[model samples]
Target chain A: MLYLSTISWLQEGPFALYRWNSLKEDLPLFFHAFLYTIGISLGALALAFVLGIFFGILSATKNKGAVFLSRIYVEFFQNTPLLIQIFFIYYGLPLINIVLPVYLIGILCVGIYHGAYIAEVVRSGIGSVPRGQSEAAASQGFSYWETMFYVVLPQAWRMMLPPLTNQLVNLIKNTSTIAIISGADIMFTANSWSSMNLNYVPAFAFAGILYFILCFPLAKWARHMEEKNKKAYSR
Target chain B: MIQMEGVNKYFGDHHVLKNISLTIEEGEKVVIIGPSGSGKSTLIRCINGLETITDGLITIQDIDVTKKEAPIRNIREKVAMVFQNFNLYAHKTILENLTLAPIKVKGIKKAEAEKTGMEYLERVGLADKAAAYPAQLSGGQQQRVAIARALNMHPEVILFDEPTSALDPEMIQEVLDVMIDLSKINITMIVVTHEMGFARTVADKVIFMDDGAIVETGTPEHFFTSTENQRAKDFLSKIIHH
Candidate 1:
């Protein structure tokens, strides 16, 4: 049905593929909106990476309390919807006198929400390392933290990159959720164009194409790394 | 010097080491031989506090192993271990593997650590592979590097837990040769191995274990030739003739 809509839409004059000529003028505006989207996503990703690694290592440690606490955080964020999280932080917080800017709210919502997923990535990555690696370090008189930082994490980090990149792609795509709250991201800009031009098909399709342009290289690089790492570790 | 008096270890309901009592003096080379699952590895692992004893007194140079608050790190610094699988850091170069413990644990400066590390690597005849990662080296070379890693710490004693058992048969000789060189240096050592020849050559004492208890302890000649214990005699004949 979606394919039929795509095929039949080309028959209309102004709604046709040739409409790109008229929309070419909006490219500069789209570019700015793209930058805004990237900026929000990058900020969120940076926040997520730091918090994710912190929570990840905490969850991976031997301390039962730390693991339990991190598990609570992960389960809470992951089980809830991203839209509700953004609304809770952006709108719901103001009822109690916490009034953060919309951009900060967007970044924090995406960052922390995705941070939970990244924590799982970190936990599994560290767990994949053989127990012998850390045991060797411990037998060498390295303290627990020293063994983790020097021996286990480096090897785990290599195994983590492909999956972590996957998280990065997901985090970037999730930035579009900000539009639901009326924040000025790429999707919001696309909505404005579709509303003015009444060309929902072409405008949204263009939006998806732009998202592809943004995300394809990262996806491709992740695949390449997975293959390269497989070969490197096979020996 | 090492002492284990009435030592016992259990893994869940399975008793792994039972009523163990032994003393190892400084500079003694003790070789433990047993069939697989006889708890030889678990016995040596207890000395460095790698595996906690369920009940007993294990003191190394007056440091008690059974005490929870006692500085286990200090004991580990004095006692080094070489594993069956080498267990060298796969991400680190050979030199880095050797130097990590000294630098991180002992607070040795980088230049001196590298110098000490290189000296031991050269002693193991792998100075040329200092910059190479562990996975890049042959199994024999990796085991040699593991020995060098243990030796660079200048440990008071070293533990070998089936160190050469994981190597290819031909590769075993290279690691065993490095170990033989190690014995002549007066470092206290405990070795658990299947290679009866290594036991025959360098051990000051040979201990045979069965069912988590020491079956016999003797000098190399007495342990190998004059053993009257049926278990020891049966074990020796099996490995020697095989």
Candidate 2:
């Protein structure tokens, strides 16, 4: 009971800031962690989105071999748990003497895990483009790639925005899972803060608010873009 | 000119086209008429390489379509198609629809493509709708834009797959007039239409298909007036007398 008040007294976070130097010392580490989390997650999402959209196009094509390979890729990633998949890359990959740095492996693990879901999102978006559009493009003497690039994908892109944004937010949150593998991102920083300060509640609350700051604006931005795109199409 | 020699097409095991053969001369207009699933649309579709043939050679302007490296794109550039449903790219406005092919495929400059688009739009009487979305236009207006789009490509042969088949009765004439105007320019056209009036007015020749084969082919006067092939007579009586 005595220890509780002492703990509370020391960690009344409002007062911790009064000695600006101590708080300032930790701020850079916290900011670094925050930046790393955002960078890694966004990077992973970029990679996933590229590969996802590419494979997604392949999956929807008429070529039997491309479709078969994409199916296998999607299924394999989806069936594996993301954490186990990360572990496999971080630890098990070394057994085969694959010597990628931890950061790239971390980014790739997250990308491959999310990429499967993203590929499906992209495939359905492309599928939602009416076949008549492609036929019309072809009738105009546009090659298949030209038709897809100009006619089909532009139309599909509007529908893709909401799902793709959702996947990206999911990716940012999934960065917390990286802490288990010592990724040195924001969640790991929060863990270290709680351990050092012996005040789990305030440290977690602080980190939670930081994450909210990152993701909430993205959600609002995506919603606005979706509305604008819908209005454009409606017009 | 377009020619199909004993062409057959299969969708799965079902024979969608069977021993179908046709020939269209330069500057000639031919209309194909039949009941639904009579292979009339498929016959015209095969002419433009939209549908592949299972057997026999399809020649458009004397170039064979069956070869793997067939200048299909070059051939298609020479032959344009107008679909009944008027499948416009929903994301682009009317102006972009007309110019996308010419600008992208033919390497025409933006200003040149727009000028060509506006010219065709004027021809189809859609110059005022250059900025309008397809969904904002009426069925007739949409169909006219479709014609203008095909015309902007400046093909030698124009194929219409039931051009008025999807329009309301009042809207049909607007599209048909654009088609009629197209014919007066002496562009070679092979139109698959159920509009017997259109066939009677526009066609130099009429071909009737039933169960995937050309059951009868002749000049409109002979086929529509004097033909006695039982299936042709029956199909015409049902279509005309009805």
User: Who wins the TM-score comparison?
Assistant: 2
TM-score list, all predictions: 0.88, 0.94
Task: Give TM-score, chain B, model 2.
Answer: 0.97
Kindly report, for each predicted structure in the order presented, the TM-score of its chain A compared with the true chain A. Answer: 0.88, 0.87
All models, RMSD in angstroms: 4.0, 2.5
Predictions' DockQ, in order: 0.44, 0.75
Model 2 spans with C-alpha error above 4 angstroms:
A1-24
lDDT of 1 by residue, A117-176 (tens): 999998898999998899899999998778878998888987899889888999989999
- Best-fitting candidate, measured by lDDT? 1
- Any idea what lDDT model 1 has? 0.89
Query: In candidate 1, which residue ranges exceed 4 Å CA deviation?
Result: A1-29, A58-65, A193-206, A230-235
**What residue pairs clash in candidate 2, if any at all?**
none
Error of 1 at B48 (Å): 1.9
Q: Candidate 2 chain A: minimum summed lDDT over ten consecutive residues — where? A: A14-23
lDDT of 1 by residue, B1-242 (tens): 79899999999999999999999999999999999999999999999888988999999888887899979888888999999988999888889999988998999999999998999999999999888888888999999999999998889999999998888889999999999998999899899999899999999999999999999999999998899999999898899888
